[model samples]
Target: MEKEQKKNKKPAFVAVKGIYEIMPAEFPWWDRFLEVAEGVSKFYNFERIETGIVENADLFLRSAGGEGTDVHKEMFFIKSNKDKWVLRPEATASVARAYIEYGFSRLQQPVKLFYFGPMFRHENPQAGRYREFRQFGVEIIGGENDPVFDAQAISLASRILKEIGFKDVVVEVNSIGCRVCQPAIKKKIQKYYRTNIKKVCRDCQTRIDVNPFRVFDCKREECQEVKKAAPVFLDLVCSNCQKHLKDVLEYLEELSISYELNNNLVRGLDYYDRTVFEIFVEAGSKGEKKEENASKLAVGGGGRYDYLIEMIGGRPTAGVGFSFGVERIIEIMKKKEIKIPAQKNKYKSVFFVHVGEVAKKRSLKLVEELRKNGVGVIEGLSKDSFAKQLKMADKGGAEVAVILGQREVFEESVIIKNLKTGIQETVPVEKMAEEVKRHIK
Candidate 1:
C-alpha cells in the first residue's frame, strides 16, 4: 500500500515566483543587447569586469541607504550557519568593492569598466521587472571630480539606447547638494513636511525623519502634491554644486543630448551627491501613449558617487556610471516590434548535411575540422531523411551546403552544393576546406 501511494504521488516542482527563465527563443534580443554593449564598450575604451554574484551582505548594506531604501528592502540574503552572505542586488556596489580590493585605485586615473550580469532583488515583479534580472553598465572610477566624465557616461548610455532603437531619449537631471549643504536642505524638507505631513503619504511621512531627501523619490499622488510645494534641492545647493551642475548641462547642450533640469530628481540612494540623473524614453515617441506615470518608465539612471568608494572602505575616489535593465529593454524592443538586424558572419553562413550511418558517424569529425578552420558548421546529422536535411539547410539561410553520404565517405570526398543555386561539385577530402571556403565566399 505504501509503495503504491508513493508511485502515485505527483511531482511538486515549479519555478520560484518573481524569477524567470531566459529560454532559447528570447536569446536573440539578449544577443543584440550584448552585441551593442560590447561594441560601445570597445569604442568608449571601457574594460570589461565581473565580480562574484555572492558577497558579504554588509557590502551592499553599507553602500546602499540603510533601511527604507529599495536596496535595503529588496536585498536577498543567502541563509548560512556562518556569516550571512547575499546575492548581489546591484552591480555598482560589487564593482566598488572589487576596485578597492584589487587596488585599481593605484592604476590609471578614472579606470573605466563595463559589466554585464544578473542581479538578485526580492521585489514584487511587474512588467519587465523580475527577481533575477540582467544589467549591463559602465563605471568610471578614480578620476578627478570632473563633470566631463559625467557627460561622457550619460552620452554612452544614451548612445546605447538610441542605437537599440529607443526614441526621444531625455535625461532627467538634478543635483542633490553636497555634504556641506545637504543637511540644510534636509532640514528645510523636514520642517516643510512637519507642517503638512498629513497631506503626504505614509511613506513620505516616515521619510521625513529617516531620510528627508527620499521624499522627492515618492510616487504617490498625495506625496507628489505635497512634494511640489516642498523644498527643492536646486534652491539649496552650494555655489560649487551650482557651478558643477551648470557645467554638466553645458556639456550636455554641447553634445546635443536633450535634458530637463528637474529639481525633484533626487535618486533613490544616500551615497549619491552633486550630480544625479535618470534616462527615460519620453512618451509619444513611437506612438506610445502619454500616460501620467510615464516618468516611471526610466530605462536607466546613475550619477556621480564620490563618497560611495569611501563608504565601502576605499579612499575617497570619484565614480560615475549608469545601468539599463535588460528585461525592460527587451520588453520595449518586443512592444515596438524593433527588428534587430541579424548578425552577418561568413563562418555561420554555411550548413553541413549528411546521409546514411557511415556519413552520420563521420559528420562529427568533419564538422570539428570545419570549426577548427574557423567555419561555423551547423548540421542535423540525426535526421535520416536527405530531403529534410536539405530543407533545414535552406531554412537556416545557408549560402552553401556541404553534403556527404556513404559513397562519398568511402571515396574520401564531399559534395559541395550551392544552396542558392542548384550547382554541385565533388571535392576531394584533402581539398574540402579550400573548396567550401571558396564557394561560401
Candidate 2:
C-alpha cells in the first residue's frame, strides 16, 4: 500500500470543460458510429483524410462568405502576440484547403475523401450543440460542375443516416443558382427587405444590405413573416441554373433518391452554387406507434461549391460535400433508443492462486512467464486466503482458475480448475501454455 502510494497517481479529469473525451465508457458508441461510417464509406468508394484544427480565420471568412453565417459570426479565433489563427468551423472548407495545397487534382478526378473530427463554434450550448462538437463528413473534389455529383453527395449523406438506423431521411433540396441568377435574386431580395425593414428582425435588417438570403434562414417569429413574403430565387433561376437543377432532380429520380423541393433553403455557406441539400428527420411514422415530434429534424447538410476552390486561390474546380454532426446524431440515437453493443469480457484466461508468501513470490514469475507466452493471467499475490482469491477470480469472469500453492510451486507444476465445470487437474508449468491454449479454443 505504501509502495503504491509512493508512485504518482494520475490526475483526475474532474470538471472537464465543454464536450470532448477519450475514456473506456465512450468506446462502445464511438466504435459503433465509426464502424457504420467506415462501412458506408467503403461501400461507396470514399477514402479518409484528416486536416489540422487550427487554420487562418480568412479561410472561413472568405470561403464561407462575408455573410454572417454561423461559421463567420461564431468562429473561435485565436490572436497570439505574433500571429492570428482560428479553430475550424467546419470540415469542407478545410478539405478545400487540402485539395488546393496537396495537388489532389494531379492524382485523381473526383477525389472522394471522408473526415471525422471536431469543429468549434461559439453558439449557445443546447441539446444538439456545444462549443466543441464533432463532425463526420465526406467530400468529392476536382470534379466538373456536374449536377449529378450534387445529387450523389446528397445521396451519400442519406446513406449514412440509414446505416445508423435512422427510420426516415427527408432530403430538402434546392438550387441557389449561379453568378448570373444569384445577383438578380440578391438585388430583388434586398429591394423587398428595404421596404419592410421595420417588420424584419434586427439581424434580418442588418443582413438586408449585407446578406439578405440569410434573412430567409432566420427562425425568429418576426423573421418568419419576412421569409414568408421574401422573393424566392428558385422562381427566378436562369436557363443554365434551371437545367442544372432539373438534371439534379432527374438524377435523383433515376437513382430513386427521395427528396422535397425547398425553394427557401439557402445553406449557411457563401461559396455554394447550383444544387444544395439538407437531410432531415421523419422518425417512427411508419405505423401507429409514432412519435408526436415526427417533423423535419435536420441532422446533416451539404451543397455544391463551384467557386470554393477558386475562392481559396485554386483553379476553377467544383467541390461538393456533406457533414453530419456527431453530437446531434447521438442525441437522435438516444431519442430513438438505439442500442449500443456491450463490451465483451476481457478476463478470458487463467487466475493464479497461492496460499503463502513463498508461493505468492514464485507465483509472480510463473504468471509473467504465462503472459510472455501469450496467455492472459490474473493474480492476487497479496491475497493469502483461498476463498478471497477465488472470489476475485469469479468476479473477473475467468473461465478457469489455476491453483498454485507452496507444494505445487515446489513440484514445478500447477493445478487448473475449470470454473464452469468445477473440474481440476495437475499440469506441468512448462506445458501450461499449451494446455491453456487448448482450453481457450
**Per-residue C-alpha lDDT of model 2 across residues 154-220, encoded as one tens digit per residue:** 8888777787778677788888889888988888889988898888888888877877678868889
Q: Residue-pair clashes per candidate, as listed?
A: 0, 0
Which ranges of candidate 1 are over 4 A from the true structure? 1-12, 67-69, 282-296
Q: In candidate 1, residue 298 scores what lDDT?
A: 80
Over the stretch 283-352, how does candidate 1's per-residue lDDT look in tens digits? 3335666676564468888999999999989889999998888787787777777788977665765789
TM-score of each: 0.92, 0.84
TM-score of predicted structure 1: 0.92
Candidate 2: clashing pairs of residues: none
Question: Which candidate has the top score in lDDT?
Answer: 1
Task: Kindly provide the TM-score of model 2 when superposed on the true structure, using C-alpha atoms.
Answer: 0.84
